[model samples]
Target chain A: MLHIVNKSPLERPSLDACLRIAGPGTVLLIEDAVYAAARGSAAAPRLAEAMQRLKVCVLLPDAEARAIADRLIDGVTTVDYAGFVDLVAGHPNCQSWL
Target chain B: MTEGIAKKFMFVNRSAPYGTVYALESLEVVLISAAFDQDVSLVFVDDGVWQLKKGQQTKGIETKNFSPTYRALEGYDVEKLYVERESLEARGLDEGDLLVDVTVLSSGELGRLMDEQDVVLSF
Candidate 1:
């Protein structure tokens, strides 16, 4: 199940909701939601845990105006806009969380 | 008029007014669509309700108060503004406290409205 998160860090919900269900999926971060990739955010620990436990492939646009690339913790892969479109085109089960 | 005659494009605003770019971006899309004379409606849910709150002080944030822009929306013939009742109650706000007149709808009603929309975008 692919998860597209477009919400800011403070407004995000518990990662446990997505983590509890184990599956090989991708996570795309866009808009203010890119903050989820930022270091030291409350969402980081759980996201990291999910990546380690589940094969969660996290993707955030590198050229997106938001300067969150340098802030993302390790394990989260950064991609470009084309990569994002390709990722979505490849995945079928997408759940957008805003 | 026939019920549900128009292909409603519902813009769901979910962010606060300042400290984020989503609010302004969403408004621009709405105005552009209005220029094309498309059928559009707006719904403010979650922290998006703050955009309609009265007495906003953007000086400390060094941002302009775009609240007045919402008031001008009526002149553009885009007047279907719906605010979530639960969100308003949660934030301790009511229609009287908003910058513009809005019909407050429950979450369920809001969901139904969403289902009726041919296109939905969240900001």
Candidate 2:
């Protein structure tokens, strides 16, 4: 399954919920959720731990839009919308954590 | 409708309108999605139920009232709208209080329906 989270971790529990249920699947951060991928944000440590188990990525456009492209944590891959479409197609199902 | 494949797409609305841009932006995606001719459905749960409440007054907020645009969804061939029964009841809302007609389903049934979708987008 592909877990897509679009809510800010600072404002909502969607990222926490997604991390709890995401097994070996991919977690793609989009919209405001991209903030969680930043280097010194509140979600960085948890995201680092999650990266050890599964692929953790952030939408490149979203990160760039927020001017955090240079601040993304190490090992978090960045993907474009076409890559997002590919991830969706490759996964059996997708759960959007709002 | 297109003569090719159509994937099942479900847009889950879980927030109230106007408070945030999610509800409005989600509606924008739904409207644009009609061009793809996909099998699209919408599910309203949690505060999302408030989006359908009738006589929404945005004058106090100075925002354009977009709730009425929901009634135009059918003309775009996007007609599958579901509201969670438990959510409505929990919020002290009834079917009669909603602005649009919808098929109300139990949370369990809605979960099953969600599992059947190929794509699920939440807002």
Candidate 3:
């Protein structure tokens, strides 16, 4: 399954909830959720652990918008909207952890 | 709703009480769900922890102080409240600083509780 989350972990717990509730799957972080991928952020350590079980990806444009594109946690893949579509197509189903 | 069987409904509050409308909106729904006699559970995480802090003075911000409403939740029979330990500690807050009683649990523990719920609402 593909799990999508779009809230900042600093201001909200959507990312944390998603990481906990979701099984092994693709986690696509968009909007403010991109902040969780930034290195040195409090949420980064948890996000890094989540990578061991899931293929974590962040929307590049979103990260760039936040200016954290350069400091993403080591293993998180950067994707554009095109990559986003392919992920949805690849997964049997998805949950928008909105 | 269903005649007699009460479904477990968890309301996951993730927003602060002020600066946005989400926190207040979430509380209003919790009240209605109680009226329907559903089993209600409230979980606070991240900035949502601020909602339960003691002695909030919203007068300076001109926003209606609503943190006290959480204290009133028990009168509505909404007793099950949980706060994420990590979120609380990260914010430099503890149970004693809160206005009401709550069980602090880890994310893993909360996830198990969420899995048992029939419905989960997030704000």
Candidate 4:
């Protein structure tokens, strides 16, 4: 399954909840959730840990929209909307963690 | 409806309108997605029930009233709109208060319907 999270970790527990149940699959961060992938942010360490166990990715357009693309933490892959569609096609199902 | 590839897409709306852009933006995606010809269904749960409320006046907030646009969805062939009964009752709203026609379902039924979807997008 692909877990898509679009809320900022600072504002909501969506990211934490998503990480708790997300096992060995892909985690695509979009909208405000991309902040979790930024280096030195509160969610960076948790994201770093998640990266070791899952395929952690951030939507490039969203990250760029928030101007955090240049500050993304290590081990986080970036993809565009086409990649978003591809991820949906590749995964059996998707759970959007709002 | 793509030839031999019509996937079930369920959009879960859990946020209220106006306070955040999620509700309006989700509607935009829903409208654009109609061209994909996929089986699209919308589930209004939690605070999302507010999006369907009638008599919304956005003039005070200086924002465009997007609620009216929802009525045009049926013209785009995007119809399956569902509202969680518990959510509506908890919010003190009833089916009659909604601006658009929708099927009211219990959360359990909504969950089963969600389980059947190939894609679930929440906003």
Candidate 5:
């Protein structure tokens, strides 16, 4: 399963849901969703823990126009748009929580 | 309308066009998807219906009124525009006030459409 998140990183419902359901899958961040992996974001620490436990692969663009992408915890891989699409196509179940 | 082709994509617009970047960004994505020959459908609910209102004046806000862009969508082959009937009534707007032709659907019908899509993108 691949979950695509495009909402602000601080949002709780989507992140909580993702952690509960995502097991050994992938997480692709696009648009504002990339904020979760930023270095100092409040959401990063919790996500990092979930990422480790689930063995989830995280992908986010290096930059966005309005906000700088930072705070990528260990083990989360950054990827580009093509890689994002590939991850989506590869998954049997894809959910976009925007 | 090619029969049996699974090219349908649904876009759910949830915010007003000018208040934030979401609306404009969604429009660009829609155009891109349509360019790929996908069957595109849009659902405007909540404050998103404000994007379709006629006679929008954005001069005081120092930004261009993007209300006109809805009309240009037809040129790009994105013609399946839907508006929640309840949203229009709540906003005191009717089909006459929208600049584009739209199919007004009840909430139940909208849910059915969402289930029928091959792809669902919400913004």
Candidate 6:
């Protein structure tokens, strides 16, 4: 399964719920949720810990748009829109953390 | 309308009811999805657990009280409802507080259940 989050961790509990509830799946951060990929942010450690159980990916354009492209944590894979579509297709199904 | 291809669908609700449109919209979507004959389950976590709290008085708020519809889900054969124990405890609510009966599971158990589903929808 693919877990997609679009809200910032600071503003909403969407990412927190996804991180806590999702199993061994791919977590693709989009929209404001790309902030979770940033190093030293409040959502970083938990996201990094989840990496042991799930794959972590960030939407490059979203991250770049927020100007946090260089601040992302290690082992976080960046994907474009095509990659996003492929990730969705590759997984049996996905849950968008709204 | 494919009669025999039922998918396991788990709808994850994590927002407070009535504060925003999410809870109501999710309920509407769930009802529509049931027509497809999918194996549907509803999971309430975080503030979403509040959606099932009994005695919702929306008369003063002027919002149509939609909590009653949850009781009607079983009629649609969408009887699978699960709530996170941690969430319930945090909110000081128990099974008796909810309008419907639901299987309460630990967050860990809930994650495993989520992994088994063919589709997960979050609201």
DockQ of 5: 0.08
Please, what are the lDDT tens digits per residue for candidate 5 over residues A1-98? 56677766575345544454344567776667667777777877877787765444445443445355454566777777787777878865465755
TM-score of chain A of each: 0.76, 0.97, 0.97, 0.97, 0.77, 0.98
Clashing pairs in 2: none
Best by lDDT: 6
Q: Can you give the lDDT of residue B117 in candidate 3? A: 69
Tens-place lDDT digits, model 4, residues B50-114: 99999999999999999998788999998999998877997899999999999998755775676
Which candidate number has the best DockQ? 6
- Per-residue lDDT value at A59 in model 3: 96
The lowest-lDDT stretch of 10 consecutive residues in candidate 2 chain B is B107-116
Per-residue error at A46 for model 1, in Å? 18
**Tens-digit lDDT string for candidate 1 (B1-123):** 345355567787867888798999889999887776668899887778999998888888888778889999999999999998877887888888999999988766775565565666665
Candidate 4 accuracy as TM-score: 0.61
Instruction: Write the residue-wise lDDT of candidate 6 on A2-81 in tens digits.
Output: 98999999998888888877778899999999998898999999999999989999999999999999999999999999
On residues B5-123, what C-alpha lDDT tens digit does candidate 3 reach at each position? 99888888877888889999999999999999999999987788998989899888998887888989999999999998888998999999999999999877876676676777776
* Predicted candidate 4 versus true structure: per-residue lDDT over A1-98, tens digit per residue: 68899889999867875675455579999999999999999999998988887899899999998999999999999999999999989988888877
Clashing pairs in 6: none
| Model 4 ranges off by over 4 Å | A1-91
Clashes of each: 1, 0, 0, 1, 5, 0
Ranking by TM-score: 6, 3, 2, 4, 1, 5
What is the alpha-carbon lDDT of model 6 when measured against the actual structure? 0.92
Query: TM-score, chain B only, every model?
Result: 0.91, 0.96, 0.96, 0.96, 0.91, 0.97
TM-score of 6: 0.94
Sort the predicted structures by DockQ, highest score first: 6, 4, 3, 2, 5, 1
The per-prediction i-RMS, to one decimal, reads 8.1, 4.9, 4.7, 5.2, 7.6, 1.5
lDDT of 1: 0.72
lDDT of 5 at B9: 88
